[model samples]
Target: MTLRSKPYHWLYAFVLIALSAFSVQSVAETSMEQTGELQLWHKISLIFDGPETSERADYNPFIHYRLNIIFTHPATGDRFVIPGYFAADGNAANTGAESGNKWVAHFSPNHTGLWKWQASFRKNRFVAVSAKVDAGVSGGFMDGQQGQFTVSESNKELPDFRAAGRLQYVNEPYLKFAQSQTYFIKAGPDAPENFLAYQDFDGTFHNDGHKDDLVKTWEPHLTDWKKGDPTWQNGKGKAIIGALNYLNSKGLNAVSFLTMNIMGDDQNVFPYVDYNTYDRMDVSKLAQWEIVFEHAQSLGLFLHFKTQEAENQGLLDGGGTGLQRKLYYRELMARFGHHLALNWNLGEENGEWFKNHPTMPQHTNERIAMARYFYENDPYHHHLVIHNGIDYDDLFSADSHYTGASVQTHKADFSSVHTAVKRLRDWPVINGRPWAIAVDEPGDAQHSLVPDRMNPAHNNARQNGLWGALMAGGWGTEWYFGYANEHSDLTAQDYRSRDLFWDQARHSIAFFDALDVPFQRAKSHDELLSSAADYVLAVPGEFYIVYLKDASHQPTLNFKNFSGDFEINWFNPREGGEMQQGSKTTIQAKWVHKAKLNNTFNLGLPPSTPNQDWVVVVKRK
Candidate 1:
C-alpha cells in the first residue's frame, strides 16, 4: 500500500490508548504502535498514546512536553537520538484535527537489520527548550516505552532518495550520497521563498493582510500533478505538488523554501497556529507540509530549508539561541529533519548588510551559537549553511560549525558569480577543509534571472551565472527571480515563466553527469588558461574542463609539466547532447622551457558556434 494509506493502521493501535491513564507511570505500561514501510531509508513512525492536548492548550504542549527516541541498529551498535512531535489525532493531515492524545516520532533507518527503539518522554515548564536529555521530569504516558522493529533492504531505485540513502557532507566540495557514494550537484530555483504560503494550507495567511498579495496559488502547475501522487484535505495540494512535478520534469533537482518568514518579505509562511504565536504549532498545516516533502524526496529533490530571513533572523530572543529560538529549531527538526536529503539554512540574507535599517542583525557570537545548536542536535547531521547578505567572514573563523556557504552576488549580469564561488571554495579554514559553495542567488536584486520572454536567449545568465558557477568549482546554482521584474520572487506562481532557462540549467547539470566528470576532485584553475575571460576546472594531468564564454578567443592550455597525449571534445551548454569533436582533437605533450610564456598548447576552436559559449573537455588518452 502507498504511504498515505498506512495511517489507517493507526486505528487498530488506538484501541490500546483507551486502556491507558494520564498518570506518569500508567502510560509507560502501554505498547507503542509502529507504522510505515519497514525498510531502509523509508520513514518509520512510532505512535504513542500520550496525554491529550490541543493547539490552544494553556499548558502549551509544544514547550511543556518532549519526546525523543533513541534508535539503535543492534548489529553495529550505531544509535541515533531523534526528536518527536505531537501529531494531533495522528491523522491531522486528512482529518484536519487540532487536538488528540497521539504523540509521534519519525525515523529513517540507514541500515537493514533488527532495530530497537526507546522513547524518553518528559514534561516540565519550558522543558522542550533544553538540550539535555534529562532536563524535565518524566512525562506520564510512554515516558520510558521500549519497542523493536525490522527493516529490510530498500526496493527503491534512481531519482528516489531511498535508493541513494542520505545526502551527507564528507568534507568535500560537494555533498555525497551515503549509499551510492555519488557526488551531487544542486541546480534549481531559489525564488518564491514563500512556497509554503499556499492558500490551500490550513492557515489564516490567505487573508492575514501581511503581504497578502504575495500569497501563491501555484495555479499554472496544477496540470502537472499526476494521479495517485498526494494531496490533503481532499485534494488541496495539487498545485504546489504539480509545481514540483514541473521542476523534476525539467531535470532540476533542488528547491528552496522558508519555514518561517514572520516580519520578513512574505509573512504568510510559519509553523505557528497564529501569526503572533511562537510556542504553539499548527499541527494540520505541518502534516500537510510533510505530505509535500515526502513526495519531493521520492522525486529526487534536495530540500533547502531557509529557516528564516533577514527581517526575522533576530525575531526570536533577539537573535540569541535562547528558549524561543531553541524551541523553534526543535520543532523544525522534529517535524522535517528526518527527510533523506536536505540542508538547514540558518537564514536567508542573514547578518547586518543593510545600512540604517531597523533590523536587529545577528552578531558573530549569536551566529556561531545557532550553528552549534544544529550541529549538536540534528541526528542525521544534514548539511548546515548560512546565506550571506554582506560576507561570510563571521563563519570563516575556526569556531564556526557551518559546513557550506549559500552565496548571493550583487552583479546585474551575474559576472561576479565565478569570483564569488571561487572565493568561498578557496577560503582557508582552521580544519583545512573546503566549503561546499552554491551560488544560490546569483544576480543583483533588481534584475536577477528575468523571465524567459523578456530575455529569451538568457545570454548573460547562461554565460556568466550558470556556466560561471560550475566552471569555478561551485557545487551548483539556484536562480533567484528579481523582485523588480515580472514573475518576481515573491509574486511567481508559475514555473513556466522561465521555461527556456530551465533547459539551459538542465544542459549544464547533464554535462557533468553524462560525461562522468570528476568534479569532486577538481579545482578551479583559471590561471592555467591563456585568456582571463575564460574559466577552467582541472585535476592537472588527469582531466580538464574549460568554459570559453567567447569560443572565438583561441585560449590555450598550459601543458608545460604534463606528459601525455590528450583528446579534446566540445559540449554545447546551450543545447545538451553527445560530445562532439572540435577542430583540434588531440594534443601531445612536448618538452618546453619552464620559464617561457608560450609553453601552452593551442586549444582549437569549436566545430560550429565560435561566437557562443562552449565547454571543452580534455582528458589524457
Candidate 2:
C-alpha cells in the first residue's frame, strides 16, 4: 500500500494535459532572458548563455563559479544585490538536463519603470567569501553583463502575492505584508510530510525502498486544477497544484512541506538528484517545484519550506558548519527566495532525541549560525522560524534570526496551546524583541486530528486546537494528522479528511476580520475571569474578548476598577453562527452582575449556547 507501488502512473498523462493547459503560457521563449515581460512584484530572470560545465556529481559547480547581480531601482536609487544560480539549460524542468551553460539571476521588482542590472561572474576557489583575485581570466561568456528593463504596474487582483507586495519580518511579534499593513494569520494542513511525492516530477523516491508505496496522486484535488494555471512537463503537477487551490477555496492560507527529507520520515521529498545523493541537485525537478510554489503565491497561500527533517540532521555536513550544507542552503535561497511570502523552517523537530543518532542535538551557537546565514543572504528577508522537539524551550533568544516560534505539542486536546503560545510571546520580550508564535503542529502523536468521517463534531479539536491558539494571541494553527489515525500525517492523500474542521478555521478568521480585532496590541489574561474555563485577550476597557471554554455555566468577569457602559455580543464557536445580543452591561467599582457600582464590576454573562464553546465580546459604548 505504499505510494510508489500504487498503479496511478496512468494519471501522469492526465496530469500532463491539465498542467500543459496552463503551462502553455510559461512555455520557453526563444531569448536569453529566462523570464519574459513581468508585472510589478513578478520575478524576472536573466539568463547568461555560456559553456556547459561538469555535472554536479563530477564536480561542485557551486564552489567554482559565483554569479552576483545588482539591480538598481531608478526612481528611489534603492540598490538590491541578489545572488544568482546555475540553471541547466533554463528548461531543465522539461529537459532534465544536468549540464548546460545557463546561469540565471532572478529579480522581483518593487516598483515600476526602468530598472538597471549588472552581473559579475567570478571564479573562486572558496565560494563562501570573495577575495581579490583574477576576475576576467577564468570567467565565462556571461561575465560582466549589463541590462535594463521596464517593470509594468501589476494587474493581478487580490489574494495574490503580487497584490500583497512582499511579506517581511520587521522585528515584530507577527509578520506583516509590505505596503498592505495587514498582519498574517495562517490556518492549514501540517501533514502528509511527502507533499511533493507526485508522479510527474523527477525524483528517486518512487524506486527507493523506504517509501516506494508512498506515492500520492492527489486525486481529490483534481477539480481544483484551474485552467491557465502554471504547470510543468506534460501535466506533471496538476493534482498537487490543485491541492493549493482546494485549501484556498476552503479559506486556509498556509501550507507546510519538506524541501528535503532524505534519510528521514517518508524519504520521498528532496531537492537533490537522488534519494542517496546530497551535493548534486536535480535541476529539472527544482524547476517543477518552483512552478507549484508560484501558483501557491498567486492563491495567497504562505509557503512553509521545511529544509531538513530530524532523522537526517547529521546526513549533510555532519550537523556541523560544513560546505555541503552551505551549498544546499545557498541553492535554495537563490532559486526560491524571490518568492514574496514564505518562511524557511530550519528543521522538523530538529534535535537528537535518540541515543543512537549520529548527531547530538544542535548546540545553541550552531542554530544561531544557521539563522544568521539566512538573515544575511536573503535579500527580501522573509520570516524565519524553527520547529521544535524536546529542546523547544532552548530556542528562545533575543539575538537569534528567528522571527517566531513554530510550535509543536503532543497534547491531543490542545490544552497546552494557549499556555505555550503565551509563554513564548512573553519570554521573547525579555530579549527586547517579541517573537511571533504559531502552533504549526499540535495534538498527540497517535490520534491527532482525525477526519470528519470519524469525528464529525471535532469537539476537542475545535474547542482547543482552533480557538485556543487564537485567543492566546498566537497567529494560527495548522492541524497535524496523527500517525495512528486513518488519514495520518505521513499518509494523508485527501484533504477532505478534515472538511468540518476547515470550516471552523474559516469561521475564526472571519470573526477577526469582520470585527477588525486589534489582536496585535492585545495580551492574553486568563485570570480576568473567575471561572477557569474562560480566557480573555483584551485591551481592557477599549475591547475585551472572553472565550468560554467549558460552556457549562454563566461566568462572571472581573473587570476590576473598570467603570463604563459597554455593549456585549455573544458568538457560538462550535456552530459558526452570527453574533447574538447579550445583556447590556455597565462596569463600575463593585457592580454585581448588571448593577452599576462605584469603581469595579463583576459582569455576568448568560450562555449563548448551553454546553457549547462561546466567545463574549465586550466593547465600550
Off by over 4 Å in 1: 1-28, 592-598
Model 2 segments more than 4 A misplaced: 1-31, 34-37, 126-138, 358-360, 392-394, 397-399, 550-552, 585-608
Taking all chains together, each candidate's TM-score versus the true structure is 0.94, 0.88
**Looking at candidate 1, what is the lDDT of residue 328?**
89
Cα error of candidate 2 at position 443, Å? 0.7
Give me candidate 1's TM-score against the actual structure: 0.94
By TM-score, the best candidate is 1
- Write down the RMSD of all candidates, one decimal each: 7.6, 11.7
**lDDT of every model, 2 decimals:** 0.88, 0.76
> Which 10 residues in a row give candidate 1 its minimum summed lDDT?
16-25
lDDT, candidate 1, 111-203, per-residue tens:
998999888888999988777789888786787778899999999998999999999999898899998988888899998888898988897
